[model samples]
Target: MTGMVTQARPPRRDDGSSVQIGALVPLTRPGWIEAGHHLLAGLELAASDVNDAGGIGGRPLELVVRDTAADPQKAAAAVDELARLGVAALAGEYHSVVARAAATRADALGLPFLCSSSVLDALTDQPTDWVARLSPPQSRGWRIYADFLLGAGHSRIAVAAQPSVYWAAGTRILRDYVAPRGGTVIELDMSALTPAAVCDELAAHRATALLLLVGHPEPAVPIVTAVRRDQRLAETMIGAPAGQPEFAEWAALLGDDGAAVPFLRYLPERLTPLGEQVETALRERLAAAPSFVAYEGYDTVTVLADVLRSHGTDRARIAASWPSVAVEGTRGRIQFSRTPDISVWQWAGPPVQVVDRDPAEAEPGRFRVLHTG
Candidate 1:
């Protein structure tokens, strides 16, 4: 029960007749618990719906949930245990590095994994068919974010980065995309500086925008507060390309200061009919509007259930079905294919948007689409 989290829904039969999918999510500290909750909600909802509609060839769809707590080693261990337990496939993980660990283990064990929300470009060192992803890669999303910054006239940008492969990759993507367009990237080492110090650096560097490549609430919230309060940095824009502000907790913690801070979200401007229905159900389930991460979670199961039905739980067959997948997800039509520089079968066209909570809105969750890519 230490690493094991809730099962989400009880199995239809106590005789162990359910089809199991090992779910890796960050449900505890150091992980973004709010995001995990949303992600799990979508996964559980989709599974419940699948069971209602004939139960994947008459066996209940079960999610054996484990809390990764945003640790890579923890994720790898969970993957190994799940593989040993004979899950047909693996799903769900929000952190990129954690998902990478899970992907690596799943590949080595020959367990098919449909990564839910992690967007790291290099999911595995070598290409493997055992793994696939539902989220857009960090490079593609972050490069779009960089374009947004440039179009908005923010040429000099500063990033307060944490020491992590995901954050480092995001920083590198921004730098690579923006440098040729007369933009400069300044890195603010969060380990060596305080939030106030970060604000001072933003002012001193004359950074028109400060992108938070750090974690939420602890440093990201404080950094936003410091920047918003500091008169010297009043003109500088605050951004979170990794989408800290996409959750309700960000607005709850930072309130007005959290507004207008642009962040990347993998949602389209208009939801499809299925997306609209899922949104309503997800809102009712979560009591808050679901982030794009929830959609990714829902889509993960949607794809896996299709594969399981067609391929009949054979691990190799499920992995092999990645290319021929053509399921209608809550988003758009979901399919997987090899993308250049990416090691897994990727959903290459998930909608990418730079959005922000409207400061003028009386409601907290109201978002304004600023840019799309």
Candidate 2:
């Protein structure tokens, strides 16, 4: 059921015709399945909303999901499959590696792809006119993290990055941003290290802040908890740009230690009416707190539906129309940049905010915005 593409029965569409939007997600992957499910929840809700609004050109929008399982080769193959299946546009995929691979294939096939959650800077590096992204690339997003740390007067920092291209790219960006600002960055390869080892390394460096760029919150919970227990690094400012705030059990796993750890997300301080509506609907349907990927997935589909509505299902026309089209999504307005350096053809720094969970909140994932960039 998780990987299966589900659509509302007929009568939701006019003439029983549907324009399928292809979604590439991690449905069966160990660390990514939960995120994939949340993304699907958002997509389903958005599809329903579009259908209720009479659909795109009277044809209901349908999502055809293909599981990438966080594998690059599978992601590329899925893009080909989605194109062969005659999807109007493409979206989804949580991992940057998968997104990058899929985007290339989607672009090669002349299909329009809107990346929902990948943050690798190079995902938009190519001159592929057919691809665009809703998530801010790591290059732009890491600046927000760097600025936050420098602004908070913490110059001595340590980075614990997982062995993924997503985290590696972020580590590189953070180092580039910090060194020029008279700050020092100590790097730690967290692939095979234990929580105690990670703590010892940070403590030895007298690190005032720790930047966790891990792939999941599982490692982060123990590492952060253990580091906080050390007297030397007890007050170290812990921050993660790795979508930790999106996990429903983020707080439950991290406990009180997880409090005040800032993370990068596409959401803002205040939710618009539409954002609130989506939040409420997702809560009821999923019976769990929705993650940031859910919001991104919802907005990506909304934008895709709108684009199809205005320009029909012609991929070339839709890709061409993206520049001038201003999409109002869950996270304020969505606008793609034509600039070459700034994650080319991406929603130019789409209102990313650093938020943290308040330990007192009943729902742990209900993070409050601590900083905005």
Candidate 3:
């Protein structure tokens, strides 16, 4: 969590004998640091496991990590530097916008990038074999979330959204998906309103559900507190489709207030044999339950290691091998193909679940599976 570079073991041969995969992660402020920590934990853990299982053709798989700090320009620059450093492939990014920038640069450089946790539908403006993704796209996940909202009898929905490409795309996805089903999405620009003003708007609009299309711990935590304490909106549901409640920081900040806020998670009803083992290792590594992002990190390495073994460390071969990947990941059998509207070779079926912290359970990480898609 603290180091920029992480290696599974000392080099078996000379320092230059190992295969290096460039990792792009956000490890500082303004980024989701907690999510970044878990992501790095999974990536490093899998790298260690790959070494343990006789690394790619007996060469140690090393990770040369660079912190993006959630900045797209910074991430693009990191991709350029990593390419110059001779990394055969690139991996690991949480923010969708940052991943988009990194993916574009990686494609231009002809370096294969296996994106770990960015869910934006358009990872690139045009499809290319250079980029592939583990996480489901925003349109698929957010549309499932909208269906969960409509199924729960929440017809009138309000979104307190900040201005960003990711937030705007989520808002548009919810609006387009929900409008046809008699559900209305009312947008409240968070830049122009305080937490108290958001509550007032919710009450004025008579919204039954309020979605936080904003960042964590600032407006999101305060807005949840305001809406929870307000007597007028006691029955209103608070939702974060971006998976804010999956992290311990949200529960630590909001406590029971954070419970019951349904969010999107890409996990199955039960972990596969590989998944269960990785979960235990990740919990020990992270000192808490691993979020879905952690599993994404593990699977990204899992796929990349297999590719490196099969195709050597050549960048062109790695990019060409994405469609033929058939590794069994922690969650399920992982495979990549062209998904409709998604510009990357995507894992078409990473399990999507709408889960919330169960207030009934007095524990922090206890989540109730409300609905699955």
Winning candidate number (lDDT): 3
**Cα lDDT, model 2, residue 164:** 78
Candidates 1 and 2, the one with greater TM-score:
1
Clashes of each: 0, 0, 0
Candidate 3 segments exceeding 4 Å error: 1-3, 14-16, 361-364
lDDT, candidate 1, 226-335, per-residue tens: 89999998899999999999998998898888999999999988888888989999999999889999998999998999999999999999999999999888878888
In angstroms, the error of model 3 at 315 is 0.6
Better of 2 and 3 by TM-score: 3
RMSD of each candidate relative to the true structure = 1.5, 2.3, 1.3
* Winner on lDDT (2 vs 3): 3
Please say which candidate is ahead in TM-score: 1 or 3.
3
**lDDT of every predicted structure (CA atoms):** 0.90, 0.80, 0.93
TM-score of each: 0.97, 0.92, 0.98
Candidate 3 lDDT over 1-373, as tens digits, reads 3236779863476545889999989999788999998999999999999998888888899999999899999999999988999999999999999999999999898999999999999999998999999999999999999999999999999999999999999999999998888889999999999999999999999999999999887889999999999999999999999999999999999988999999999999999999999999999999999999999999999999999999999899899998899999999999999988888999998999999999886565689999999
